[model samples]
Target: MIKNYIKLALKLMLRKKYYTALTLVGISFTIMIITVFASFVDQIIGANTPERNRSRMLLLDKVSIYRNGKSTDATPSVHFLQHLPKLESAETVSILKRNEFVSFLNGKTAGHVLQQTDENLWNIADFKFVEGKSYTTDDVKSGARVAVINEKTKEHFFNNEDAEGKSITIYGQAFKVIGVLKSAAAFSKLYGDVYVPYTTDMNLHTTEKAIEGTYSAIILSKSEDARKVRTELRSQMRKIGRNANGADSLKLYPFSSIEQFAKSSSSNDDEPEYGKTTIILLIVMVLFMLIPAISLINLNLSRIGERAEEIGVRKSFGATSGALVKQFIIENVIITLIGGLIGLGMSIYASKLLIQVINSFDPLFKMPTDTFIVSWPVFAFCLFSCLIFGLVSGAYPAWKMSRMNVIYALKGGNSL
Candidate 1:
């Protein structure tokens, strides 16, 4: 009996080929759009590292004073680096100074800036080495003119040749390339095409004798007790320096806190309106799925009306309403499951097309090479969503057809 229902469903679909094609296309297109956007958001948020550890901490100065009836733009001097209180739980401290606009190897261009950092900088963040090794404590102490170039810089300068051990003149000083870093995600916040020894680069560019006293410091904590340490650090800084009103003027942030700050402070130009955009997309997709599902339900109702005499014969021969509803549901599930498989194939092709478009924008913008292929979780999600839509849409018509009056249905005068 179940087999007969499937046969009838297939025959019905084939009889209305245009409607069946439209339904399949609608489901496939909606799934494609959702999957592509999901992959994109995953890539953006998971830019520097894996999604699970998407948190980082940032410290700032909280002091502000009013002058001439307006708030003054007072911030902690960059020289505050020298006064950073040593926390027992801190692993390493890295000093950074950005956007100095110094000259590179060629004298013709002099607009690039060095992102200065200490030797253990890579340990704090996941920095992949493509060539040579990262800086060491000795390099910092000796004020070595060594630098690390990112993949983009390598391609730009050296082209196809090896970038390591190459001497590049920056700000009229020659610096050796001791390392080359792999390309980072385009949307990453911690982006630098070139990294130089903090103290060394500072000495060459400025007349200052010691840069450790003036650079911004990042203190890395070894454990998850970041919040406690943050509180302690802020208290320590406040104890060392206070405003006129005796209020704490130091700011502290934990690893998780920084990410939230970044999200809120992000520019609205290209940012995804996660809440409204996702809700709107889901609503539109559901509506797209509904239209065809409604058509299928109407088709089923018409077929059941034509088979009213047969349904009456079955009821007279002892078929229960429950049995009839079950048969119809099973038939719809089979059709939906078949459509889902096709939709899965469509999703794969769509993912590939999306990857191509992204890569075409820039060579470094390739889809994640590791685990780039679709996973079982994605497949399962698509299948589950498809089944739910199928079941809900098919239920009403099946239930209505099953409740027909047997004697009246047998008389066959549009009983439904």
Candidate 2:
């Protein structure tokens, strides 16, 4: 029975080739756009590579002080790090300070992200090593000037030469390149072209205030432990706020890997409304899908109207309304499924194109990956969306066909 429905659906599709092509293009194009956009979003927020442990990570990246109705914001302080309460839930913790370093090598000038971080940053945020190894805890404690350079930096400075044991000159300071890493995603907390011990940079470790300075902290733990960890960190931060001399109101901002990016674009600097941001994103995607589905419905209505005579003939031959509806829905689903496959292929190609276009702009924008990998879950969700798309657009037209007067339908009219 299903085979017959598919055979008829294919025959009808070929009968009106241009309309079939138009419908497929509409569905395919919408799927391609949404898939590619979602893929990039997953790359940024979802656990991809070095950020694989993101689901279990918490970051206290910012702090704010309210003074006399004015707001002063800064990175979480070294002082806060120095006095952090024991995070019993944490698997690993890191103290990180970010700055830019300029390098002039082989008459080429480039700026690189210089992350002054403790060795624990290596533990909390996974960095895939191309060669050599990350600086050890002993290296950080002794203020070793060893550096870990990313693959892009390796390309820029060495030009395909082996980087380990080589010396890289950054900001007129010579640091030995002890490790080379695959470039992490640009938006990740671990994002940097060069990583070195914070102990090596006196400016980063020097505490300017008890609650405000240029540093941040990340804690990684079991997924179930995140809430407990955040609660403990907040309590500790509040204690510091109460104990500090001449302290106004001190507030710590805690965020997950995804929430950090979501909240970053808020107009308010004090506290972010990320729930609204999430809702807005969901609505935008829904609207995009809805427009294409609406077009499909209108197109289906026109095509079904042309099949009024067929519907009347089938009804005359004792076809039940339920069976007719089922057949039409099956036909729509088949077309949508075909369009989904085309969309899947197009999305993969478009993702690679997008990556190339982004990297074409500048060296500083270079990320690790060349291919945009659409995760299985993402594609699966899209597949389910296609099924829903098929049923919804098919239903109304099929119902309308079932309601038509048998005599009018025989005369090729839609009168009910």
Which regions of candidate 2 fall more than 4 Å away from where they truly are?
66-71, 107-109, 205-210, 222-225, 261-275, 355-364, 368-372
Alpha-carbon local distance difference test for all models: 0.61, 0.80
TM-score of each: 0.60, 0.87
Predicted candidate 2 versus true structure: per-residue lDDT over 1-416, tens digit per residue: 88999999999889989989998999899888878877777877788767888878778787666666676777777766766777777777788888897776678778788998888888777778998999998998898989999988899889969999999876677899999998876656678999998888867546655567778888786564456776676676677664553555667666676666676767664345678778877887788688999999999888766999999999999988999899999999989888987998899888877777776787654554543578787798778878887898898888888887888999999887
Best by lDDT: 2
lDDT of 1 by residue, 56-142 (tens): 333332233343444433333344554467876677656665544444444433234357777766766677787998888888778
The whole-model C-alpha lDDT of candidate 1 against the native structure comes to 0.61
Clashes of each: 0, 0
The residue pairs that clash in candidate 1, if any, are: none
lDDT of 2 at 206: 61
Error of 1 at 211 (Å): 14
